[model samples]
Target: MSERTRYEANVCVLLHRAGRWLLAVRSPGVAYAPGQVGLIGGHVEPVVGPDVFETTARREVAEETGLDLAGVDLHYLSSELYLGDAGQPVLTVTYMGELADGIEPRVAAPDELSAVGWWSLAELSTVENCAPWVPPLIADAERLLRRR
Candidate 1:
């Protein structure tokens, strides 16, 4: 890795309702993490100025899931920095918020996602069904929620 290598930044937000969490299946063409059940998020683009992270979270969540997160305050859960499968540094900031009582996520970006569904928290005990990075963030959300 070059000392001057720039890391790509992405935001991931988890929404939980009725003991199930929202996730999407990546279509086989994305540059990273394709074809795995992963969070509802995307890269942090520079359009949203001061609140870059939060804005990116809102945009990605809406664009990818068709869920209008307007006024849904996102709380930070965790972050991880590591080399992607392509050996480039990727930084993912994880956030969590409750899925509103009656609202649900749908597949809004057909090209980027193949399907969208909720996964049982219990079913996620094993990592086979999701990206390797998912479990820890979910654990962090659970831990923090427990403390509330």
Candidate 2:
């Protein structure tokens, strides 16, 4: 049998005022379960002379959450590995960005996003069944908070 290729992607976890971080609830009807909160990001598309983070950050943010990155400061958060079916590995490059002008997350794609909102890092930590990928992301957020 031949080996399968692993996918690499970059993610941006948008944080808003009052220490609230953005989350997208995965829609239930899809292959993955619905109502699962996750950071906003997608694959890092190839572009001329573009770094992994720069190329995907703005586009991924627009795709996942309908918020624009105008004047927002994007900070490198952390990177972690996520598993796919058959134990395949996917690397997620995560970041934290503050809202520039008090805009909120809207449903850019209703089918893919059942709901979107901001929650405190503490609240997110307390979520009973947050996705397996969240703890590391939260740790990254805490680190960012400390530096502030």
Candidate 3:
């Protein structure tokens, strides 16, 4: 049999403000996790050169949530492999960071996201239609936040 396709690299940002985490509602037309609450992020573009994971995370957060992570300290949270909607393997790198003071999230990319909101850990866990990766990522983010 032919070799399996290489896994796509993606990055996710768990943006925290006060005691809440930022989550986006995926656009209904999106290929992965459509209509579900999920972290703000997207695929790492190959053309972006080295250190693209963090670059992509920053870009995606701005694109999807209209928030700037410029001076925020992004702490690496975790990484995992999961299948995308197209049945391709994706290696997702997750990062956690605090939202800069006085900034609020809005749905910046209407085609990619429908809404943006901040949720506490308990609130996030109670969301019924969240993406599968959300729960674990939230737990990881909680630990990271605690140490801050």
Candidate 4:
């Protein structure tokens, strides 16, 4: 038998508005898929806390997009296995979140994120060359929104 593939837990945050959402442009130098547009999130650290999902979600948004969890209405969406190069799996726990007014993210960490901005679902559908796994995750989120 061949070596089993490895998977790591990650967090995904959906910042949504009136039928729109936020997407971040990943830095071009990251070992992972670089220069791809994706939801704001990252690996879930083991020490994140008892509420690991929430902690990681909050931390990820802060790290990548500078969005604090304050007043952000968040709901658990789904867990998905995202296949990257060499079939490496990033098992992501996703959340559907709505941001409150009077808050926005800047390029606080240039090394990790090149840019961040909001986009409508229709606009996202037309974004060329997004990370391969992102489209599926967005579809799932859209379905979840419809049910809500």
Error of 1 at 51 (Å): 1.1
Report the lDDT of model 4 for residue 56: 86
Clashes of 2: 1
- Give the Cα error of residue 97 in candidate 1, in Å: 0.3
Off by over 4 Å in 2: 1-6
Which window of 10 residues has the lowest lDDT sum in candidate 3?
Answer: 139-148
Best by TM-score: 3
Candidate 1 lDDT, 8-37, residue by residue in tens: 999988988776788888988977677888
RMSD to truth, every model: 2.7, 3.0, 2.3, 3.1
TM-score of every model versus the real structure: 0.87, 0.80, 0.88, 0.83
Ten consecutive residues with minimal summed lDDT in candidate 1?
120-129
lDDT of each: 0.83, 0.71, 0.85, 0.80
Error of 1 at 38 (Å): 1.0
Better of 2 and 4 by lDDT: 4
lDDT of 2 by residue, 1-148 (tens): 9977867555555565666777778777767656778777667765657466755877777776777775777777777777766686777777776675457778797778888887776787777657866766766677767788
Candidate number achieving the greatest lDDT relative to the actual structure: 3
- Against the true structure, candidate 4 reaches a TM-score of 0.83
**Clash number for every model?**
0, 1, 0, 0
The Cα error of candidate 3 at residue 119, in Å, is 0.4
Runs with alpha carbons beyond 4 Å of true place in candidate 4:
1-7, 82-89
Q: Report the CA-based lDDT of candidate 1 relative to the real structure.
A: 0.83
